[model samples]
Target: MAKKFEKIGENLEVKNIVIHQLLKDAGNRLVNPKAADNLLTIGEKEKTFLGNLDKSYHKKSSPIYGIFAEENPKFRDCLIDYINGDCQFYDFSINVMNHYKIVLENTVAATGGYMIICEYRNIITSNDLLLILMINNKEGFVIDEKSLTLDNIKNLDLSKVDVACLINLTEWVNIENNLPSERKTYLSFVKGMKEVSYYFMSFIDVDNKNTSTESTKRLITAIEAYADIEQWDRNTKINKKNKVFTYCHDCIDNKKEILLSTISSILNPDNPEHFQDFATEEAYRVSEIISGDKVRMKFLKTITYSDKEFKIEFDTKLILDNTIVLDGSGNKLTIKNISPILRDKIKELSNKNA
Candidate 1:
């Protein structure tokens, strides 16, 4: 009955800000500036906290804490592996991400159209081809990047991207500086992205402003639309008789009337309460496609644990917030152990599963 929206909780706020600042700051020195000053102010005794020394950042008496920053994502062949490790995901003790300064400009040069930025967990290159193969045609994957070009990548199937990503450039860049933000003549044109996945757009250095951040906030209406739900308050509707109002006079008569529309049987009463439920259902469908029950269970349970922790420690919206719903049956199953194959099976369902 409520017009649901995703809320970014407090726990993720600091890290989210830090990551953005890190990207924004790029390779600039963390000395004498406000970002540095803020850190130094809070960490008078922790000069090495924000500094780039990987080895000495976290000494026993050091105040510089970066939970899970030390994780070797290469070990996360699947999302299930990360989830299986439990609270270890939040232990940001180090920044193990590789910078793209080596080939940053070249990669960007290769891009000629609107594209999303994909932050790979571990595997970047070969995985892109393998993912394309699975999503479109198994034969589309060309592991040999020797002859690969942006044009070739454009021609390949991109429906199956398996990573954490942020989208950008929704128009062709053959002519930059001017673009129709809402519409494009191209067939691949899509507007207002509502989800995240993994894919490498290019390698960018730590000091590059072009580098994309990981966390992206999605709205409830936008999410429902992606799930193909029938009724979500996305468009601002107006009545001819009283056109300035977003809702008709009937809604003015009853405060709850407008709110009820989101869940109204007139729209789709049978629809699940949360947007993540739509995602979870998609995961189930993917699990069916992948035919891996153990993997599915592990993915769901791992997310459940993470969600629980987020809710307890930060009161932030879990990725599964009202958007995700576990049925009575799903709620009952608990996984104690999971295998890599099972994890991949989960990845086949959703990014969190992998």
Candidate 2:
């Protein structure tokens, strides 16, 4: 894989700077006075402040943080350790970094990114959510609730959801001080916006009915295509052969050579720790691309071969560990060895591209 980032190298540098700066600040140096406004500000900005550090700052890591908070409280304890200086960012930062590293490795980037997005939304809602959103980035889920939609959402599986945000977008969520006329319109708007976001993020929500239709085939086609056509440098790329790839604690030995040999050469790796993030991001970029409505529509990629033309849809994982068997009925025949047909169709498409 072409390395496009070095998160640990980038973050450790930022963490060191943050701690050094935290120690220097007027109030943080004095005490953790819960009541003192200046002292409390540290905690307020602690997560967000630490957030400003990742090399891929927008890489989306909130799920990693949340899962750490949920599954291993020890990770949170590790944060306390940082406060105590038991873990130094320069040397042992890698050891302490394991806490977050574990979470990031297990969870998908979109999930983490969504979590951060939700919490940040929650933070906004903590304040008045009804303004013109003129004071942007100030409080919880800043939204223009006036324009929202939920009519087109079909009964589908909402399992792929990364986060569930309860946005009080309606005028009902407004402050009680507002007059009835102004409040009514705002409440209606919030309801609409919330519904739209809910369905939008719930990408793979396949309802049982939809699952049985041509749509199911369409959906899987969308998923695999998205995975195949992502954003990494293809020259140095090594596509995972239908298997899970885990993170390595140590740096790769031949990263530079192997990467430079192929299309992956576009990425640089002066700092090696970023390999995981880069590979994952590239996968996701491809995923989002293939998942687009137009791209997904191609998942079924209809083909013309010999005198007959048929749809050539393939999913790498759908059939595994066993041979495919053809089933026949009174008026129907199903065949399993479709590889040759698929290869031929792909070759045909290649000719067109050429």
Candidate 3:
């Protein structure tokens, strides 16, 4: 099977990494304090943590989307200065941590987590990138290295990423140097499931213009057009539609975004780029990455009919799975494998009528 993101972790280079602990103050409810010193060491645990984060950042289906926010460019300017050798990595990281704290304090409720500022290169493209990740630490017991005794320790939680952002330094510089491709977005970040991570966006000063609903609608139209152009049989068309619908529904349920490339691969794995090229040529306006809109996605997952007296709904997969068969001649549905409760209810109704 092909990987979800084929280019992730390819020719990746980790230049510098630093993590600072953010803790909520007990005395002061609003103020959150940072640890005395940052962890500059990149051990095996850090390596695994960074690897997972890199994959999430590059995954086209991820909720991460590109943005261009020039109104408030403080963070972007700082990055540019660092890239120009105006400051050392450690100093630049401290500024990033401090700025994050300011955003948290001024805006919504402050969150406590380990703020990781990493400078890496060549993950998705040959671009020197800086990724910032915020993750809560797990409370666990560990043997102390000095005393050789079990002590309470806080370990970085590798399972969940609370918030993250990737800054494409090379792309930004190229844009500044009067590059040709002006539509490029150098900043991309994860849109977390909750509002607590909204501060991360404020810290970076970027805005996402593309919405998930519009993208989904465009995607559906493009797929239908592509299927028609290829002259697929009715059965083949239905199967492909169901397959893509299931993929989109899963992404929405999992709080992940839909990737056009992933959908293309699913539609035509032998020629993965075939669908993408068709979409481009047809001018569908489907975004490369789309945040899954749960409300909009409901239309794709189920078939439903409703009236004053009767309302019936069933999963789209039920038809193909042979559980619910449709007869065109009779213009009715044949529902098989009825549940015991439903069967009993129908029997009771029949006995009462008799």
Model 1 — which ten-residue stretch has the worst lDDT? Answer: 125-134
Residue 331 CA displacement from its true place in model 1, Å: 11
Instruction: Write one digit per residue (lDDT tens) for candidate 2, span 125-149.
Output: 2322211000111122222122211
Compared with the true structure, all predictions reach lDDT values of 0.22, 0.25, 0.64
Count clashing pairs, candidate 3.
0
Q: What is the descending TM-score order?
A: 3, 2, 1
lDDT tens readout by residue for model 1, 275-323:
3344225332211001111111111221213463443111112223533
Best by lDDT: 3
TM-score of each: 0.18, 0.19, 0.54
Report model 2's TM-score to 2 decimal places: 0.19
Query: After superposition, which runs of candidate 3 have C-alpha atoms over 4 Å from their true positions?
Result: 1-10, 25-29, 35-39, 43-45, 140-158, 176-183, 191-196, 209-354
Query: Which number leads on TM-score?
Result: 3
